[model samples]
Target: MADVPTHLALGVEYDGSRFHGWQSQPDHRSVQQTLEDALGRIAAAPVRVAASGRTDAGVHATGQVVSFTSAAERPDDAWLRGGNSLLPAGVAVRWVARVDPSFHARFSATARRYLYVIQEQPQRPALAGNYVTWSRQRLDDEAMHRAAQVLVGEQDFSSFRGAGCQARTPMRCIHQILVRRFESLVVIDVTANAFLLHMVRNIAGVLLDVGAAQRPAEWVGEVLARRDRKAASKTAPAGGLYLVEVHYGDCFQPPPPMAPLPLSGIRDLW
Candidate 1:
C-alpha cells in the first residue's frame, strides 16, 4: 500500500458551550465529532482528528488547531468550503494548510495562550452575555495585576491544576501572566509551555480572590511555592475562558488565506 500523509493542520474556532467537550462522545455533541464528520464528508471517507488539547465543556477557542492524515490530497479551499459546508453554525475553520508528515499538532506546539474575561459590574451587560463572566463584587484590578506577576516563570502549578487532569507532570513554564482592566472588564492573558487541565480557569479563580481582597497578593507566590492543589481557589466559569492562540516552532509556515463567506442565508449541517 502507498504511504499516507501523517499531518494536515487546521486552524479552528468554536463556541464550546454547546458540546460535551472537544473529544467525541457516544451520545453527546463534541467539537471533535463535528470536525471529523465534516472532514469525512469532504474526503468521501472517514477521518480521525487529533487536536492540540481538549477544552472542557462551556469553554471556547479562537485559535484551536487540529490535524489528521489521509491518502487523499485536497486543496486548502476544499477543506474550508467542504468542511464548513457540513459543520454546524458555531464551529468554523479559519484556515487550513498542509504540513510535514511528522508534524503533530499537539506535540509540535511550543506554547498555548489563553484569555479570560471578567466583567466587574453590579449587573452583566446583555450585549456581552456569552463572552464574559460577571462578578458583581468590586475588584481591585491593581492588586490582581500584582498577584499575577508572581505566576510568571517556571513552577509546579499543582495548585492550579484541575483534579481530573491526567498530565504526568505538574510543572509548566509560564511565559506571561498579565492582568489588565479596561472600563468595567478585567482581562487575564496567560501563555505557557503547556497547561494542566483547567489550569487557566483555576488560576483565574485564585486571582479573583486576590482581586476581591479575600486573599493577599503574596498568597499567589506562597501557593506556587507550596505545590499543593488545595492552596488555590475554585475554578472560574468556563464561559469566560478562551484558547486565544498557539505557537509552534519555526518550521511551520503561515496558514493560507481565508475566503470570506456570506453571513446570511446559509444552511448548516447537523
Candidate 2:
C-alpha cells in the first residue's frame, strides 16, 4: 500500500440535548461517534478523531475542535461539506484545515473557553428549555460578577471539583470569568488554561445562591477557601453549559466560537 497519512483539524458545533455526550459510550449516541461515522463514510474507511475536550451530556458546544489522520486524499472543503451533509441536524462541522502531522487536538490547545446561559424568568421556557437553563428565583447578575472576580488567577479549585474527577491536581489558572445579563439571559463566561471536572458548573451554582439572596456574594470566596466540595453549592445543570472554544495561541488555528445566546451589543469575545 502506498497510502500516506494526512493530518486534519475540524471545527464543530452541536446541540447536546439528545446526545449522550461528546465521548462515545456503549449503546448511547455521542458527538464523537456521530462525527466519526460521518467522516468514515466520506473516507470510505473507519476514522477515529480526538476532540479538544469532552463535554457532558446535555452540554452544547459551538467551537469544538477535532483532529484526525486519514489517507482519504480529500480537500478541506470536501471534509467540511461531506461531514455536514452526512451529520444529523443537531451537529455540524463548521470548517476543516489541513495541519502539520504532529498536531494533536487536546495536547496542543493553549486554553479553553465556556459559556453558561441562564434564563432568569418566573416561568420555565417552553421553546428554549434545551438551550438555556430556567431559574424562577430573581437573580442578581451584578453580584455574581463581583463574586466571580475572586476566581481569577491560579488557585486551588478543589471546592468546586467533581467527586469522580480524575485530574491529577486541583490547581488551575483562570484567565477571566464574567457574569452578566443580556436581556433575559444571565451569561457566565470563563476562560482558563484548564479546568477540573464540574468546575464551571459548581461556580455557577454558588453564584446562583448569591443572586437569589440566599447567600452573600462574599460566601463564594469562603467556599473556595474551604477547599472542600461540600462547601460549595450543588453543580448547575449540564444543559446550561457550552464548550465555546479551544485556543491554540498561534501553534494551530481553529474557527472562532459562535455565541450560544447571541443577544446583540455583546462587545466582548464571549
Candidate 3:
C-alpha cells in the first residue's frame, strides 16, 4: 500500500560565498541543487525543495526556510540527520517539523527581514571578511536613518530594482527601516511584505551615499518620486546582506511566540 505524503517545513542556514545562488542553475553550484542532492541521497530518490525565497550569489541567510513532502513516514530527526549527513560543509538544517499541506513556504510568508552590516573600521575583519562589508570611511548614522524614513510604507521602488528583476510589480510595502551605529559598525535593518531583486542592496547603497554625505536625505524621496532606476545609487556588495528572519501567520506554531518588545529599542542588528 502506498503511504500518504507528509509535508515538512525545514529551517536552513548557509554560507552563500561558495554557491552561485539559491536557485538551481545548469553547470553551477547552487543552494537549491545542493539541498536537493542531499535530500535525494537520504530518500534514495529524487527530492524537490521549495524555498521561502531565492537569494542571489554571495547573499547569506540565517533563518531561511524550505518545505518538502515525503511519502515515507519519518520523524523530524530523520530529516535533520538524513539531510545533514549528505549536505556539504557551510550548509546546515537547523530544524524540521510537520506543517500543514496548504503551507507554501514562499507564498505563505507574511514578511521577510534582512540585515546589512558594515564594519567602518580601517582594518578589514579577518574572521568576517566574507560575511560583512569593510569600509574605512566614517559614516553619519543620523543622516542614514533620516534617509531611510523616506522609504517606509508602500511605494513604487522601481528606482531600487535591478535591470534583470522579473517581478511583475515594483510596488512593495516596507514595514520597517532602521539604521544604527555600534562603535565602528553600521547596521541597516529592513522588514517588508516582499522585496524586488537587488532592492535591499540598492537601498543600502543609496543610504551609504547619504551616510558618507555624498548625497542628501532628500535624494531618497526624489528617487522614489521619479520611478527611474538610473536615479538611484549603485547596488552595494552582496556580502553585507543577510536574510535574518521570515514571518508566517499566527496559525503556525513552528516558531515560538515572539514576546512584545519595544520595536526601535532592539540594538543587536543581524
Best by lDDT, which number? Answer: 2
> Cα lDDT of all candidates, in order?
0.82, 0.89, 0.85
Clashing residue pairs for model 1: none
Of candidates 3 and 2, the better by TM-score: 2
Ranking by TM-score: 2, 3, 1
lDDT of 2 at 210: 89
Model 1, 88-138: lDDT tens per residue? 988989888788877877898898888888887787668666668788997
Q: Candidate 3: minimum summed lDDT over ten consecutive residues — where? A: 256-265
lDDT of 2 by residue, 29-76 (tens): 999999999999999999999998988889998899999999889878
Runs with alpha carbons beyond 4 Å of true place in candidate 1: 1-6, 125-127, 253-270
Q: Assess the local accuracy of residue 101 in candidate 3 as a C-alpha lDDT between 0 and 100.
A: 97
Q: Is candidate 1 or 2 superior in TM-score?
A: 2
Question: Which residue runs does candidate 2 get wrong by more than 4 Å?
Answer: 261-270
Report the candidate with higher lDDT, 1 versus 3.
Answer: 3
Estimate the TM-score for candidate 3.
Answer: 0.93
- What shift in Å separates residue 140 of candidate 3 from its native position after superposition? 0.7
Candidate 2 TM-score to native: 0.96
Candidate 3: list runs displaced more than 4 Å.
253-270
